[model samples]
Target: MEKNSQAVFPNHQHSRGKAWRWTLWSVLLAAAVLIGVLQILVARAGPILKGRVVETLKTRFDSKVELDRLQVSILQGLNVTGGGLRIYPPDDVMAAGAKAPLISVDAFEFHAGLLGLVFKPMHVGAVHVRGLAIHIPPRKMRQQGAAKPRHLGKVKIEVDEIVCDDSQLVIGTDKPDKDPKLFELKHIVLRDVGPNAPWPYDAVLTNAVPKGDIHAAGSFGPWNTESPGDSSVMGDYRFDHADLNTIKGIGGILHSTGHFEGQLDRIAVQGTADVPDFSLDTANHPMYLKTEFSAVVDGTSGDTYLQPVQARLGESDFTCSGAVVNVKGKGHIIDLDVDVPAARIQDFLQLSVKTEPAVMSGVITTKTKLHIRPGPESVTQKLSLKGGFVLKRIHFTNPEVEDKVDMLSLRAEGNPKDAKPGAPDVHSLMTGQFEMSGGKLNFSNLNYTLPGASVALAGVYSLDGQQFEFTGKVRTQAKLSQMVASKWKSLLLKPVDPFFHKDGAGAVIPVKISGTKSAPKFGLNLGGKKPDQASR
Candidate 1:
C-alpha cells in the first residue's frame, strides 16, 4: 500500500500505536480542563460552604460554644477556625446517645478536611486561639438538663493554638441557691494542649501566683460509666489572692495548693494551704482563722460528695479526720476521730481567745465525736463530744508561777444537761460523756506568792462536765502540797494537810453530784452523817 493510504488506514502496528497516542492525549487534556473547573468551583463555593457549615454547627451546639470565623476549601477538602471552640466529651460513651458540654475557644486556626484523601492526600494547617474561658460545673448546672432540650450530642469543638491574658475560671456551676457569694476567679493565664502534640505547658501557678479571688486546678475529665477508675490525672492548684465571701463563716488571704484529679462533679484531692492572715470582715475585716495546713479527701460517683475528710494544721500540727453529715434534718454532725500530739484549741475556741498563746497547747490522744444540733429553742442547742483523752499538758496559766509550772493533765468531761422524754421537743442534742485520764498535772510553783508551791501527784479524776460527781483519783503515796494566802487562810475552819485531809485550806474535798440525768443534784460529805445532794 502507498504511504498516504497506509497512514490513513493506520497500517497494522502504526495504526494501533497512533490510536493509543490519541487516546492518551485526550485523557490528559480532559483531566487538565476538569481540574481547572474544579479549582474555580472551589473558589466560588468556599463562602457559601463556610456559611452552611457555620449554621449547621451553631444550630447543633446551641450557645455553649461560639465559633468565630469559619472557612472551607472544597478542592483541598480543608477547614479552619479563627475563634472560640471547646470540646466536651460524652459522659456515657456506651449509651446510644449522650451529651457533654463544650466551652468555646477565644479564636484559633484549625486544619481538618482531608480525612478521605486516600491516594494523593493533603495536610491540614494549624490553628490559633485567644482569650479562653473554662468552667467547672457544680451542683447547679448539672440539674439544668439541657434547658428544655434544644439538640443532642456531646460538646466538642476542636482548635489549634491558644493565647490568653486576663481570663476567669468558674469553680462550680450556677445553682438555684444563688451563686455562692464567695466563689469567683479573675485574671488567670492557663496552659495549652493539643491532639498529636505533647501537652506543652510553660504555665505555672505557684505560691501567690496567678493571683485571683479563687484558684482551682486538678485532673479533670467527663464521667465514664464503663470505667470509673481509668482516669490518670494529677491535681495541682494555686490560688493567690481571692475574696472569701462564699465561706461566710471564714475569710482570709487564700494561699493554697493541692493535688487533684478525676471527673468533674466528684473529685479526689490531697493538698495544703497557708492562710497567712485571713478574716470575716464586714466594714473593715473580722479575722477568722490564720494557720498553715494540708488536707485530703476521697470522692466517688453519685455518693461522691466530699463527705469524710482529713486535715492537718501546721501551727498546732494536729491531725483530724471526720465526716460532715446532716442528720435527720435537725442535726449536723462534725463527727471525728482526732489525734493531736499537740492539740492547741485556738481555732476551736476562736471567740474566747482572740489572741492565742503557745502555752495553751497540749498533747491529746483521744477518740472523740462532736455532734451539733441547732434549734431555735434551748433544748435543741448543744455541742457534744463523748470520748476519753489522755492529756500531756493543758495549761490554764497561773501568773504566780515564777517557774512557769504551767502544765496539767486533766481528764474532764462535759455531758449535756438532761433530756426529758416528755420534754418539749427541741433541736438540741446532749453533749455525751467526756473523760481524761493517766496524765501528770503540774500546776504553777507557788513558793513566792504564799508558801511552797503545790503540785498534784499524777492522778486520774472524773468530773461531771460542769461539776464533780464521783472523783476517781489514781496516785502514788507522794504527798501533794499547796501554798496558802493569808487572806484565804482565815476561811479555813481548821489547819490541815490540803492534799489528803478533807478539812484543809484551799482543799476542794471530793463531793458527789447526783440525781436523775434530767435534774442532777449535788451533795457534800465532811465527816458528817449525811449531806443533801441532787442533780443540778
Candidate 2:
C-alpha cells in the first residue's frame, strides 16, 4: 500500500506541473494576439474613422459632402497627419458651382495627447503644417420662415489675400463680384506651428505703409475668453524714418523703440521709448529725448479709464490727466482733464499762424479736453468738449523787461465740475456737479512787466466747452488804452500789421462758437454787431 501511494503521488505531481506550464504559455500567447489585433485595428481603421467624422459633421449640419484625401496616423496615440481634405457646399446650389468656393487644407498634423503613465494631466505635442490654402465660400442664409435650417440660407464664398507682407491673411467673400475687403487680417506669419496661436506677434508683421518700415511684436494671454485684455505683453515697435506730423510738427528721421509689460483687465503698463533727436517743426526745433512711461490704467470703470496718464518727454517730466482726448481719422485734440505742470508752452503757440513769433514761457496747468469722434452719434456728441483752462503765470515775449511779456507762464487746473468721484472701480479723485453748463478759465493775478498790471481771465464756455464768451478786459492803474499804447507798439515792430497792434491794446473782444461739440464754430469780432456776430 505504501509503494502504490508514493507512485501515485509522483504521477499526480508531474501531471499538475505540466498543466500549470501549459496554462502560463496559453495566457502569454493570448496577450500577444490581443496587441497584434489592436495594431491592425489602428492601421486599417484610419480611413473609416475619418469618413465617419466627416459624415457626423454633415449629418449634424444636414449637408452632403465627400472627402478626397483621408489619412490619419498616431505617434504615440494622437492624430498626426490627415490629407486630401475638402469641403462641398450644400447640394441645392450644386448647379451654381461657380459661386460656391471649395475649402481645402493640404497637410494637417495635430499633436498632444494624455500621457497616461503614472500621473500627468496635460499632454504636450507640436503640429507641423505644410503649404495650406483654402478658398472657403460664404454661407448662404435662408430668409425667415424658410422650411430648412440656417445653413440653407447661406451664400457662396470667395477668398483672396488683401494685404500681405509681414502678415499672411486669407479673406472670405460671398460672391466673386463682391469686394475682397469683406474680411481681413492685418498681418500674420507662421513660425512654429503651435497649439497656442496668435503667439509671437513679432514672427508676423513686416511693414506699415503711411507710417514706415514697421516692426511689431506683442504678448496676449487668454484670461477671460470674452475680453482678451492684455494680461502681459513685451514687444519692440519701430517705425523707421517716418514723416513728421502736420499738426504735431514732430518730424524728422524718426525712430522709436519701446517695451510694455503689464496686465490688461486691471491695466498696468511700463515701458521706455527712445526718440533720439525727434525734430519738431517748432523751435527749440529738433529735440531728442528718451521717455520712460509707466501707468496703471483702469479699463473697467469710466473714471478709472479717465485717470491720469504720464509721459516724460526728454528731460521734461509731466503728468497729463482729466478729460478724454477722443480722436477721429487724422484730427485729434488734447481735450480732457489734461494738465502740464512744467511744459514748454512756446512749443504749442508757435504752431499757429502768427505774424511775429510769440515766445511764451510758463508751467501749463489746464483742465481741458478735445474731441474728434466720428460715429453714429451727432457731430455735437461725436466731438463734444466741455472743460475750462486755467493759466497761472502767462509771460509774454519781451527782450527789454527782466522777463519778456510774451514769455508767459500759464498755470491751470480744472476738473469735470459735475462728475462725482466714482466708486473703487473708478479713478475719479473728486466728483460733483460739473458746470456742464461749460467750464471756466480763471487767469488769476497775471503780473506784467512795468505797470504791474495783473491779467485776469474769467470766462464761461459753450455747452460743448468749445466757446468762451465772457467779460474779459484789461484792468490796470493805467487806462486800457494807455497800457496797450506803451508796451505793445514797440513790441509790434514793422513786420506785423498796424491795426492788430499788440496783445494789451486789442479791443474788448467778445467770443462766440457753435458747431458739433467736437467741432464748434468760434468767432471773436467786435467790429460790427456785438451780439449778432457771435453765438456758441
Best candidate according to TM-score: 1
TM-score versus the correct structure, for each prediction: 0.43, 0.40
Mark the 10 consecutive residues where model 1 has the least summed lDDT.
407-416
**How high is the lDDT of residue 382 in model 2?**
44
Model 1 stretches with alpha carbons more than 4 Å out: 1-160, 163-198, 201-232, 242-246, 258-268, 278-315, 323-336, 343-352, 355-367, 370-388, 392-395, 398-536
Q: How far does residue 506 in candidate 1 sit from its true spot (Å)? A: 13
Superposed Cα deviation of residue 384, candidate 2 (Å): 8.8
Q: Give each model's whole-structure lDDT.
A: 0.37, 0.38
Tell how far residue 478 is off in model 1, in angstroms.
Answer: 15
Model 2, residue 250: distance off in Å is 7.0
Residues 1-536, candidate 1: write the lDDT tens digits: 69787687646778799899999999999999988976765565445434443544454434433344555565445555554455442232212232333344566444556442222222333444455444444433343333344454332333333334334333332333223111122333223332223332223332221235444443332222122223244557665665444333344566666666554343565555555445422112333343333333222211212323344433444445555443333433444565545455443333222222322344445556544443332211233454644444343222322122211101010111221122221211111135332111111111111121222221122111222233222121222232222335534634454445433323333333333222334344344321122212
Q: What is the Å distance of residue 442 in model 2 from its true position?
A: 13
Evaluate residue 282 in candidate 1 and report its C-alpha lDDT on the 0 to 100 scale: 19
- lDDT by residue (1-536, candidate 2, tens digit) is 99999889999999999999999999999989977966775676465455554654354334455556555445466454565555544454444332432334455554434232112322324434343343333233111112444443221111111112312223233343333221122443333322234344443333332245556666444221211232244555555665444223345455555454554424444545455555433233455555455545332221123345555553455555543222323222334454556555554444221313433444444444544343443233344444443433445343322122221111001111221322111111111111331122222222222232233323333332344343323323322233332355535532332343345543233333334322333444344332223332
Error of 1 at 463 (Å): 21
**Model 2 segments more than 4 A misplaced:** 1-201, 206-256, 259-269, 274-291, 294-308, 312-316, 321-335, 351-356, 375-395, 398-451, 455-474, 478-536
